[model samples]
Target: MAFQSIKHFALELDGPDDIVYSSGEMVTGVVILELTREIKVRSLRVLGRGVAIAHWLENRSVGVNTVYNDYTSKTIYFRKRQHLIRDNGDLTVIPAGRHEYPFSFQLPEETLVTSFEGKHGSIRYWVKVKLHRPWATVKKIKKEFTVIEPIDINTPSLLAPQAGTKDKMARIWYRNCGQVSITAKIDRKGYTPGEVIPVFAEFDNSTSRSVVPKAYITQTQTFIARGTMKQKRAVVATLCGDIVGPRRRETWHGRAIKIPPVGPSILQCRIIKVEYMLRVCVDVPGTSKLSLELPLVMGTIPLHPFGSRTSSVSSQYSVNMEWLRMAIPEQPEPPPDYSSVVTEEEAAQNSTAVQPEEDLSGVLQPSLLAYIQEFRSRPPPVYSEVDPNPQPITMRRRCMTC
Candidate 1:
């Protein structure tokens, strides 16, 4: 046979999960090879590359025939080439039963954007090995890895609370109808996966019909190429609130919503971007719904304890980031039992809002961890509700001034 000595060629990373490798860190791995006999090797090389590519075809109509136009764009973040083993004067043969060659490379410190993949386009980081020989064909193997640029949630802008107010009017037959208004706020603008977002909202309905209020978190991915753009949006999590009676008002006091497993925002990339939003909306009958949107930044590092941002930087580095990638619960929560519906007597008579308790914790969304292996051992996040402040009901007075 022409080639018989080469038995196995593979790359093995130091960590069990790819999520551990991030920017400004050395990605150390070993190249393993097995052979029955000694073989003369030209060179064994390793290549590390990070790139963002966007490609899609758009259908264009010309006269009667439709033509597909390809829209493609790519941005190269970095490229590194290194030699694991080369044919020097003395080192020519790789003797055999089983051999392991170690390699290490430090990722670029200049803002290496987090890795991401999408349908229209993808931003990826990978390591590949090429084996060259004088008498045999070249052999190659590649493996994708993750690079998470830690976005600390304790920053000034992300730590500040966010609030918004919006109102919409509904009309039937062009006649002037009542209006519905919503005011909503959250504790902060940034959070990692698995953390809870405290939602405080007030809904006032001046219309004749009862209105239902709902809230949901959404993720949006945008890819751009040569003045062309593609976008994908999805709802990540949803929660429903009690209805506001006609001409009545209802308020939500720190009612929290758990964030599902999702990737961090990719704002530094020029070719692609990942973003999130928290939307609170009211369903108005026979008319369009009025909604309020608050921008959110999903991050790798979680918020500081006790809702304080002063020590965020110090605290972020204190925790082991390895556990964060698989920290969240991706399982769908079981349906809640409605048997414990609260009665008027059981509800709080006070309307004042109280401070939310501290939660001691962050997950990789499916898309982010799809390539990473053997990391699903952790249990899902515990579901906790910061009971919303009860709305007090006052009885109507029937005294008439005669």
Candidate 2:
């Protein structure tokens, strides 16, 4: 095929700087093509490219010491070209100085993360222009730019478990051909008070190959109970047994326990129940590493009172429980009394009027006389011997004489 003569080609975009655009925004640009010789073209297309790259690095501090690191890279590309037309159409031949073509592409909305500031990472994108013609070779032009200010998104880490009642337990099962078979179970849903949830982790190496396995376990507990309420508690117990091809089972415990990572390994628990959540992670070390998490619900279920038993078995292993505590919600204190306050009418009716005795100064105060006159006019005072302090006989006689 004959090749087309060298032509002028350039690419430009609309949003090139630190422009903040959402995922659903339209990214637009134009590809200008100037041809020196008249050429018949076929079809043209615009393309948007997105890619993610990841790498890891390792450094050893000293002899027999090792460390590991990781890095990531991402990129995007955009491309578009003009279309040729045949038949009766309003297509004009290029006399070729500078040509302006408009192109547009839609951005994805889901790419925006709402969790972190500037949560959106940079996308190194490029625009490439390609010209295709029969009897002529294709020409190309390229330009590069970046998209910034994406929506902040917070995605929970795979190792981090959510805290709540609805969370579920996670179990992973995998097999290594002719080597070992592994089954791991984690209580991702969370634990109840006095409930001994089991994390059953098993590895079987029945293949002809001799295999050694290493495991790491981490448990976190948070006490959600407070005030006079007892704190939530958790305990993780691990047991390893060897089964050699129909041989009798040999169990290891306490000082007799010996695994690749030699030590007195005991499960760890915290006194304070986490108000938010707590995560327990287990990492198995091997060429193919697998990690899982168990979420412990803090104070959701009541801890059974002391010396209580349940008809439940260990969730991880089939171990019997001697005691179980029930979880209960804390009771609120009673409010204060507001029943003693009386209204104005009730106070007036319940009060008694005082009567004046024998004008001791030989003169009666008009205010006292007026009060006595008002009381007598309304009703006769009901005298009761129950009241030890009674009005004097002189007052009674004065009232009678009046």
Candidate 3:
């Protein structure tokens, strides 16, 4: 009779315990076994096992009191079985008590990384020892471990500043680490009207963790439209808003904040050429408030000579004066004079009277007169010329008579 008892079991492995090892690595361990009586073992084996498991739950509620729920689970397993060898070329026997055996097995290199987040799968693995005998029961012992995958980070490139602007600014952030960089563009001099300027924001992530970021940016501009005597100024508007995240639903607040006019001297020039300045400001979490000023120049549409020369040089100034207000006042323009305006029906009738009628008389005159004259002049065949006998002469008879 043969009996076996587990004496000692110890597992030794390198690398992260929760991280799956690359397949090239060797899993080594020792198992000590004792025999109550003299035992004969036909074969001794060791097994290494890896398993991936995932679980999910979903619950939904609708209307006043309706509820729906679901639960799901998935699992995958990998197993390797190897025979344990002894130094000697003979069948090894456990005489009694303490006996130790060392074993090593190779794991598959193509195994996917297991994750505890349940995104990929909950990775679980185990190493086990087993003994096989021809006439005896198999004995087994097992131990378990896990693995984690790495994260990827990315950042954007820096951009140059616009022309004619003073306080040029740039933004950058990390895609994975949530790190942000707000850089002032030293090169951007200013902006011109109708010139689309591109502002860049960059992101970088050098760490192993992934992060999500929310950003808000706004730029305000004030420029003078050169006018004679007094220059008029107003805010040239540009609005932009965007959301950056691992996913799209995140919303960011952004606007070109129009700064209040500092002084009347800022818009004092009078010519087709005008000078102006722009201010840029940004608000973000974990960073100080950012603000900068940039200078710009623009060309304006010249005022009509006679139009600006009207009676009260100041009386005709309402339009130009209103144009000088930078905030873009919300007051509505005066309503149109409806007293002189005609209704749709009346307008349609007036349009009809203004159009000339078709001249069918010239087209029909000659054709009609000719048709009538031809019909009246056609003579009726005379009935008085009727003959009692009709002559019929043969060609041979006519030739003989001649």
As a TM-score, model 2 comes out at: 0.28
Per lDDT, the best of the predicted structures is 1
**Which of 2 and 3 is the better model by lDDT?**
3
Q: Per-candidate TM vs. native?
A: 0.75, 0.28, 0.31
Which lDDT value does model 1 have at 377? 26
Cα deviation at 373, candidate 1, in Å, is 17
Q: Give a tens-digit lDDT track for model 1, residues 230-292.
A: 655455666677978889999876555777656678899887777888888876665666778
Model 3 misses residue 329 by how many Å? 44
For model 2 the local lDDT of residue 224 reads 15
Model 3: residues >4 Å from true position, as ranges?
Answer: 1-6, 9-20, 56-77, 85-92, 115-121, 133-138, 150-402
Model 1: runs farther than 4 Å from truth?
Answer: 17-19, 87-91, 306-402
| Between candidates 1 and 3, the TM-score winner | 1
Per-candidate Cα RMSD to the true structure, in Å, reads: 16.0, 38.4, 44.3
lDDT tens readout by residue for model 3, 1-402: 444344443444443332233334567666676666556666777778765433333346686775644333334446787777433445566676767677777766553342221121234567877776656677777766433111110101111233221111222452233332232222233222222222222322222332332121111111111111211222223222343333122221111222221110112211111234443333323323333344432211111233332222122223332333432334322211111122233334444222222222211122222222222232221100000000000000001111
For model 2, how does the per-residue alpha-carbon lDDT over 1-402 read when each residue is reduced to its tens digit? 224333556667764332323346566778776666655555344555543222223355776777653333332222333342332333334553566677776755544211110111222344566655554565666654433221111112321223211111122345433334444443233332222333344444444333332222222212111111121111122222244231111211111111111011111111121221222221222223222233332221122244433322222244333321121112212111111111223224433421211211211112323222222232211101110001110110012222
